[model samples]
Target chain A: MRREGSPFKGLSVVAFKEAADHMASPRMHLVMLLVILTAIGSIYGAIGQIKETVGQDPFLFLRLFTTARDPLPSFMAFLGFLLPLIGIALGFDAVNGEYSRRTMSRILSQPIYRDALLAGKFLGALMVIAICLVTLWLMISGMGILLLGLPPSGEEVLRSFAFLLTSLVYSGVWLAASMLFSTLFRAPATSALAALTLWLVLTLFWGMLAPLAAGAFVPIDPFDPSTAVHQAEIAHALARLSPSTLFGEVTLALLNPATRALGIIFYSQLQGAVMGAPLPFGQSAILIWPQLASLIAGMLVVYTIAYLSFQRQEIRA
Target chain B: MSTPVIEARGLSKRYGPAIAVDALDLTVMKGEVFGLLGPNGAGKTTTILLLLGLTEPTEGSVKVLGRDPLREPLVVKSRVGYLPDAVGFYDHMSAWENLAYTARLAGLEQQDATRRIAAALERVRLPHVAQKRVSTFSRGMRQRLGIADLLVKGCELAILDEPTSGLDPQSTQELLELIGTLAREGMTIVLSSHLLSMVQSVCSRVALFHQGKVGLVGKVSELAGKVLGGSYVIELEAEGCDVPAVARTVEGVSQASRLSNGAVRVDARSDVRGALAAAIVAAGGELKRLSMDRSSLDEVYVRYFEQVDHAA
Candidate 1:
């Protein structure tokens, strides 16, 4: 059966208005400043290291994202750490703030349904994140050319673009998470703290805890190397539960084409594979397709939870 | 009479264990200003929410403009405008921007929205501050802008929840006048407030909500007559004799009492001014001053609430 008007009737107007608000908000400015400063610092340090050690390398541009100074991590690593914070900042007040301000009822009283409002907010935050990531990518690439006096190859540019898209999706996962918390909590501060706490645990401690859990689940015989491999495989699977791990693996595969696999491999599996030979762009993309799909799926799943909750919520607020 | 613009049949709402509204039956006619008057937690706001389809009814149904609001909310909401109690707006946005946003949400074209927004602001007497952010606006200004928002939407029925709650006397009068103008322009209005005098001046009919159920519903004058047993009170000042004893003998006089000022106050079923004055003169008292008093809405409101309290 067909419905009369689209559920998303007012989506574009709401999205545009919300996107403008997000861009002009002080919270967004502060987070964007921090991300840019760290990104530039990491890229500058990577340039210095590349000049000293890999001056003649054909894929020198790729090192800008993967290389790290003694004290600082790579540009991609900084992004993997900081992007979720930005996402959380943008979304932690999405629903609750409207209620606290007493605007939710007035907005809902309009001709649109709750679907438009939720979709508009998510899309608006996503658009802002996409814009920030794309701009930062361009700035880093531009600085690479200016400082190194060498332009990136077409393949390097394509890979970096793919990395940027992956970063956008990675941030979307956190955005959806914070939006969910916003719906669950009545206070904006509570929602922000909740999202930030979950992010801290998943990004900083999940890797360490995954191994312990995996070892408990699949105990390895100390004398059997094959059992140790099985334990390692299980630990790897557990670690991938955190979106950060999935994002890190995708970044690694995209930015460093010579890397073949994310998990343990047998000697027979590597016999015919070319060592140190970068895979083609299509192969690299296919290699990380599952990881990309998982990130997108994670975002959709969290957003769907938020959407259903918002629809069920009373309109008194 | 014309068809009722708003109709609720056994409408009820319960939040968890507490019943906010219980089996409300109400009908508001076209172009008439209906008032919902009650104290806090009396379910006036809950009934308005149900009528607007903002909250779902637990056990009954509501229809706005002949369509079930729950079944087709968008269609109903498109034609109905609601100004919630303590109305809120995007503080950072200008009044024009706020109204324009609503206009767009209501599906007006850009040119049409712009034109209507200007007119709406003018109608609310807020055109001078159209470009200023709502954060800088005073409370009265915000209330006027709320009206401007409804006007921009071209609502067929305007439901204002406590539109005059926090305003000063002047602002309250101004808002009531604006509401009167809207009703005169043929828009049906449902105004919910605890201010009985305000409702008396503007609403043609009202429903008194007590403990989540409507205790009384009728025209204000009709209610005064029905509940108080009389609509008019006659007072006579005399100098020589017992005026209260004589006024009590007049036809249609329900009760008579003498005040300290030597005025006999008589509650009568109808106009008994001539009879009251002649009766006082015949009793050997010189009638000095005589006046007629109609029962105010305040008395009717208090009486209904008192009755409900006693029943509970």
Candidate 2:
């Protein structure tokens, strides 16, 4: 018999083939249509917002381009809450579908390394999502240019680029999460449901409970207004354990130039943003440094667990 | 020296408490059809998976093409083709598309991939169904597609696990012929099957697997000679049910019984047909059906397994 060599040198082709299949699949088409409609609608509405405002602060008018704290929470927080869920949806079934097909064993039988397989798949999925994100960012920027008579200033573009990177990294957390779930679970439906449930927990349930739990651990009562502020700060820090909080905090930093303190929320009023002395993006990154590290760390931890589990699993199926 | 294509030393696999494959030593030489005949859950698939490096064994060593499968899976896998017991595939892709994708994954160039896929499909007699969706294909068609995939793999050793299983008789015959063709081309194939007749027809060397071990192993001709012990079946005409009486008059008679079709069936320890034929006429029985049906692989396999089971 001939001495066999590595047969899976064409992993890139496999990745490309899978990505093409994803594009052809009905679900991806629906996802594309939904994202397109939302982007177009957001662009039209932003144009509408620019046309109607009068006598507003120049900073406040500029603020539409960069987020600032107001009666509503920061702009970045909302995007943070939504974008990762989209990432999760894109990846949740990536591994489990192969398991269901009884093809995972056949794939593992090939000469390619396990990490190569995951890397190819991750890069493929990332490319697909990046296509969507770039289109949305371009639309937002174009609308700002045409309607608001503002091509984003140099500083604004820098922050927006940083924001895009942060968003991608933040989405990496979800991709890592969903891939881990796919490996852990045998069924595609279960992997999907589990990812959705985790998204709900981070975005909705954790938002409500983690702060409240932290508040309960505090020594002070809220009836004392001045003291309550101190207690709520502790609650907010504990609440940031979930990715939603880090996303909320980081988006706030990227979107609102006036919103300073690196992302440390000191005020008791969760809805109210701290009106602090303006700080540079460098300083702001320093403040939000811990949260970003946590997000990156979270992704690594989950991926490591999934990789180990995948390596250990029998190829019986 | 020509190294054996596959060599295993005390190879065993245990799934938690259940022993899937016990300590076993095995080998398959280059350019031969080696068959492992056993029932389901008899470690046939486990053994195949081991060879592919899809699973790590609990004990012992498995070398495919002189490389440890677990340590150098890709090295071995690139030269080994496999057809699983149930030929499952992606439902969405057409047969040609699926074959092309696999070929691409197997590192074939675009032109070579195309050429190999078409040749494989044609070889499996699936040229017409090449463009059809795999989900729409019948079981036989899917089986053909699987063989096609293996063919396109261009491996020296083909490990086919129950390749013709669940196929109709005609398909089974066709599959056996396909194996024969591949074997003639000098591909070393290790085939596992529950179908005794199929294994017997296709495999030059057969191993009787029982309870995670090989109960018996030898060439079919050698085992047949050993089992029959110079015995040959003789068919002759007899009056109704008096076939036994004519057989009793024959010298060197070992066993005799009347067949369902009214022909006296006799198994002798030696060439007693000449004596048996004379005895039939002397006993007023006319010889009508006289044919020598060699003892089949089915009987040899059953006898081997049963004897092993009894000893255990």
Candidate 3:
């Protein structure tokens, strides 16, 4: 039977309630604090490095994110590494926590479909992540101007804004993945562990597993010289299967304006091209458009799976 | 006759190969406190889910207030308030905040929601703890807050699943009284519980669930009369002269037997204490005690199930 009424009738109500809960949580506070402290440390380190090579680079403002001193990773690198953790932490118990707390049935009993509840939760956490990323971006930019004694070019500002948007999407991918696990597992602790396990596998071990899987799929032939290139290409394709790899490529293209290509370039393809010359913001955006699309697609795909499972799940705790 | 607030015909739900609710039929009328009495996994909760359209039945149909719950769930859900079995709240939030969240979900406006929330808390007697976090609330307080949540939504029908399962006796009594007040104020209620005595005290009518089927459904008194063969039992303690024979002579007496304590147990169609006392006195039997036994729900449930078990 076709269901009457809009599935999104209570969407905003659920989203606002969930977002307020996220903002008030101690867990969110701790994550935001960690991000802020790291932002400050990384900006401080980048300023020292930029001062040492002052006047040597045209894109001095962009260097604030890419440059790093010893003992502290660059801001861009830290975000690439920590964004997934932040997303996972915020969403690991999104659905199952309601079950464990015995609130799922009551909430479901309201005049709303499961679509509203699951979508609201994902969007609510995604909104918080966006807010946090925007705040961090503003802080870093503000610190860079204060310490570097220069204003960023309009193009630089736009590129960094794109970078912030990419980071938000990247975090969303992990958030959706964690929520999928939360929907699958009943215990909050089990879901947390499952999400963390996936994170560890994708972040720490995916780089190594990519080549092994590729090599198995396309064995390197000793007789053919070009097979090595083919093998490397397959490896690269396999590695990009991980969301972290897609996010890392997007980060590289946005933060490093001179990035012209994400994959291996043949000598003929680089003919007459000036190396190390910065590409326009639009060109850089075009370069990572596919990567950005993949990030968004990955997020939506994971979220849709979570949505389907949650809809079919029994509401009794 | 009162119009039915809920109606189900041949409703059945199956999870894979296992039947959770088997071909069931039930009806609850407006402003009546109806109880679903059963043990765990006897399909009471499953029936509530089906009525609310949280789960689709494998077969059959159900309607709430003349609307098909499966097709028009929002309308049905808006009218029907549910307090789930072992109901839970967002513990970190204050009780008022929790109710306000549900009120918003119910589409109540700001001013209206605030007023309703205050009145609901007052009704449930939790106005003093309105701002206190629910994490500190006792189980009974939380259950009461659950009721307040239903009240704030202004639902016409309130379905409570095991509302008094874990409450202490005092809290149970208080909650039952609150449920009574809701019924008096013209709310149709469907309460599901495994506890017999609690349901007996408040419910106007009940359905006894056994193995995914309702073995019996009717007014408690009527069921007792049908199942136990008599609605009232009298115990007479007397000295001398054929007490059972004397008790049997009274009007409305259905059966009379002698117990080991030198007392006559008389099953009667109604309260026969005065008539039996006079009869015993005239029979020249010295009476020590004459008391009418209250037919409890426990006996009806047990006796009905025992017959089913024996037949099976």
Candidate 4:
């Protein structure tokens, strides 16, 4: 049977309310502070390095993200490490927090369906994250122009924009993962812990686990040299299962235009290529198209799981 | 006759192997304070959820404000206001902000929301604390804010779950008066509580819920007559007379017996004090005192449940 009325009738209302709450919250403020301080520290080191090697690079502005000096990682590396933290912090208590505060039933009793609530919360947090990312991007570019004494090339600006977009989608994967846990677990702390544990395992240990899993699937054979290639291929495929791996591959391809391929490339594949020549922006994006698709698909899958569970859950906590 | 504001037929809810609400039927008319009186876990809150379309029922149907709640939830919900048991608000937001959030969700214009929110807070006598964060408010104040949330939406029907559960007697009294005022203003109200005295004071009619089913439904006086066999009780303190014998001589007296406290307790169909006094005087007895007891919901609830338990 068909239900009456649009399930999205009050969607913007819920979204605007949630986004306002997040923007005003001390948690978002503290997280944004950590991000800004890290950006300043990393970009400071990058500018010093870029100044020393100014004449050698075509994409000097892009180097602001990739170049790093001692005691600090690259700006892109910091984002890869911290974007998941931002996403998790925003979503680990989305639904259960309402239950803890004893507001779930009251909110659900409004004229909207549960579909509006779950989707609105996700959209609202994503909007906040997007705003934070755009602000940081503008700051980094503004700092690059002021410090480097030159504007970025059109190609360099295009590649950097792609990098920013990839980072946002990467964060979406983690946000959806935590929202799924929030729907599954009643306690906010438990959901946060679970999301963090998954993040730690994927970010830190998945690199190690991939090879072991691949070795079991396609064991190395001493008699056949081709077996080694097969093992490496299997390992690469296994690593791609982790969203962190997908995000890293996408970031590498987008920010570094010279990157032609993601996985196990043979010497024969680069035999006729011009060494150190940066690919066009479209080519680099095309190279990471599958990785980008995987990141987006992973986010949608996790978010869909959360939505279904939340729809079926009892509103009474 | 008043039109029904809420109607449910054969409504049931199940959580796995356990039944939260069985096949039950109920109807609440417009402009009446209807009480769902029962112990905790008796399906009162579940029924409210079903009526509001917050949860789907496993069987049967419900209509609120002439619309099917399951099929047309927006219509039902927009016209209905619900205050959950131990209702909560965002602790960090001011009372007006909290109500404004719900007003927006209900699709009110900005200016309309502002005006209605002020009027609602004033109606609940909470205007002074409208700008204060909810965390600083007492439980009674929080409950009043829940009511104000309803008023801001201009809902035609209000369903309250245990609104007076955790309050002191003074707060309960104030809340009941507010509910009475709302009813007087032509708002249909359905409130559930295990507190018999509170429900008895505010509800024009009550349904006694037992194990996910309503065993009896009527006015409190009617339930008392049905369960306790009489609606009035008379206590007589007399000297130089047989009190039970004199009371038995009066018409409409159902039962008469002498108490250990030396008072004759008489159960009657109605207030038979005048006839009983005349009979006592004719019997040459000097009456010291005569009084009639009002029928109480507490007695009806206890006696009804006792009978049910014995049968079970």
- The lDDT leader among the candidates is 4
Predicted complexes: DockQ each: 0.54, 0.44, 0.82, 0.77
Query: Model 2's chain B TM-score?
Result: 0.91
For A120-231, candidate 1 gives per-residue lDDT tens digits of 9999989999999989988988999999987999999999999999999999999999999999999999999999999999999999999999889999998888899999
Docking quality class, candidate 2 = acceptable
Spell out the clash pairs found in candidate 4: none
- For candidate 3, write residues B112-204 as lDDT tens digits: 999999999999999999999999999999999999999988999999999999899999999999999899999999999999989999999
lDDT of 4: 0.91
In candidate 3, position B30 carries an lDDT of 92
- Model 4 stretches with alpha carbons more than 4 Å out: B231-294
Instruction: Report the lDDT tens digits of candidate 4 across residue range B94-182.
Output: 99899999999999999999999999999999999999999999999999999999999899999999999999999999999999999
Which runs of model 3 end up more than 4 angstroms from their true locations? B236-264, B268-272, B279-289
Query: Interface RMSD (C-alpha) of each candidate?
Result: 2.4, 5.0, 0.8, 1.0
Deviation (Å) of B76 in candidate 2: 1.2
The list of candidate 1 runs beyond 4 A from truth reads A1-3, B231-294
Clashing pairs in 1: none
Which candidate number maximizes TM-score? 3
Tens digit of per-residue lDDT, candidate 2, span B39-131:
888888898888888887889998899888777667677788877776678889999998887787777889998899989999989899888
State residue A196's C-alpha deviation in candidate 4, in Å: 0.7
Clashes of 1: 0
- Write model 3 residue lDDT over A16-83, tens digit each, in one string: 88889999999999989998999899989989988887367777899999998999999988888889
